[model samples]
Target: MNQNETQWDKLLKIKTTGRDDSHSDQYRYPYEPTSYMVLERLANSGLIRKNNTLLDYGTGKGRVCFYLSYQTRCRAIGIEYDEAIYQKAIANKETAVAGNRSSFILCGAENYEVPVDVDRCYFFNPFSVEIFHTVLAKLYESYYEKPRELLLFFYYPSEDYISSLMTQEQLMFYDEIDTSDLFSGDDNRERIMIFKVI
Candidate 1:
């Protein structure tokens, strides 16, 4: 953990943990906290604004939601299917500085209804490609119904996710933010990939 993370927790009063595959299955993936460094970069990337509402798919413990809410002052909704994890997020909600700006939903992304006004979505390799596509389809439905601009922010994307996202006709590459130096990974794919609807 970094000093920023310590301060963030101290100021906000929350604790987010890492991967726990023991509770994961086909539809749900393990809970791994996105690196705070990567999140800090995304928060300052200018891809999102205060006017936008961001949806965090599989938002475990609501770290992304609260962080971005603090950083950008934008509204955020975190979705988590795991009951235990969702409840934990709800607990964190009580103390979050951005609690008013951030909320948690206890439902799977594939079934959750995408809010019409949401212009940004986030993922952290949260689920399988099948569930991801389902969530994308719902987003597509919302887009067609309202036809507004939308951006999907993916962090430390996996090959399965990259391949699936690239084939989506509605999304185009907007930008990328590299964070490979933050870790000891050999593959330089340690980056945040931003995609916007075409």
Candidate 2:
């Protein structure tokens, strides 16, 4: 990478937040500060246009979806597996929306049904490989039915697994945001990968 890119990666590392593995079945990781930057970049680049539907898989505290709605005019929906996290997401939505456009669901990604109109999806390392595959299968089915453009924003992505899934589905890389600095640790090399369905 160039010097500029190296600097950007370092900057992101300062804002990365480590994953919370406290709960066995609950994948409730807090949003990193760099996530806002990624959201803004996507919005500014016209990747997440106004009026488009956005789904935040495993949304904790609804931070990603809330920021999406607050920054842009996009309709946002968040799904959380943990009851406590779901409740927190609801509360956060209420405070952020103040009678605006946003919603939340208390369900796991595998069990949750994807909306017909959802055009964009966000996943912040929300699930294990098994659950991720399950959610991806649902998304593929939905794409086949609707035949609409779908954008996936995956933070701290598992590139190999995602690539395998993308082979069957028409997905192209849109952007990648380095996020190594957002957490407090020595290993700072996290990234957010954005993909667009063709």
Candidate 3:
């Protein structure tokens, strides 16, 4: 963790740092917290609003949920598969400034049932393309049932993931929130790709 990351955690009253690959495999990826700077940029992008409910797939330690809810006053739900990390998210919620607006689910991203009100969804290379397909199917089902506006945000996506998303028939490219300038590299994956469910 860096100084700024630690400072953000302290300010938010949540400890969501470090990387854990203990449970990673061919499908699900490791647990890594999104940077505060990226989250700040997302919060200010005007995509998330106070009335919007954002569902974060693979929300390790609830950093995205807590920070977004705090910054945007939106209802944030974090779906974490790892029991240990899920518990940590729950603990963080107990003390988080936006705890009332945040919640965590102890379930795999593929098996999670997308609620009707969850209009905003976020992914960060959390799982394999197969699992991502399954999750997108679930989201599509929800969209058909409720017939509401839905947006999918993918940050630092893998090439495979991007390819898979590009092939989805029902998903149309919406917008991109560039974060390449925030980091010290020429990496092309430093951006949030948004897709609209149609």
Specify the highest-lDDT model's number: 3
> How many collisions per candidate?
0, 11, 0
Worst 10 residues of 2 by lDDT: 9-18
Instruction: Give TM-scores for every candidate, taking all chains together and pairing residue i with residue i.
Output: 0.94, 0.74, 0.98
Clashing pairs in 3: none
Q: List the residue pairs that clash in candidate 1.
A: none
TM for candidate 3 is: 0.98
Model 1 / residue 97 / CA error / Å: 1.2
lDDT of 1 at 166: 88
Descending-lDDT candidate ranking: 3, 1, 2
Cα lDDT tens digits for candidate 1, 63-182: 889889888989999999888888888998998887899999888788998989999999988999999999999999999889988999888898999999889889999999999887
What tens digits encode model 3's per-residue C-alpha lDDT throughout 1-198?
578999989988999999999888999899998889999999999999999999999998999999999999999999989999899999999998888999999999899889999999999999999999999999999999998889999999999999998999999999999999998979999999999999
Off by over 4 Å in 2: 1-21, 25-34, 159-170, 177-189
* lDDT of candidate 2 at residue 51, scale 0 to 100: 75
Pick the winner on lDDT between candidates 1 and 3: 3
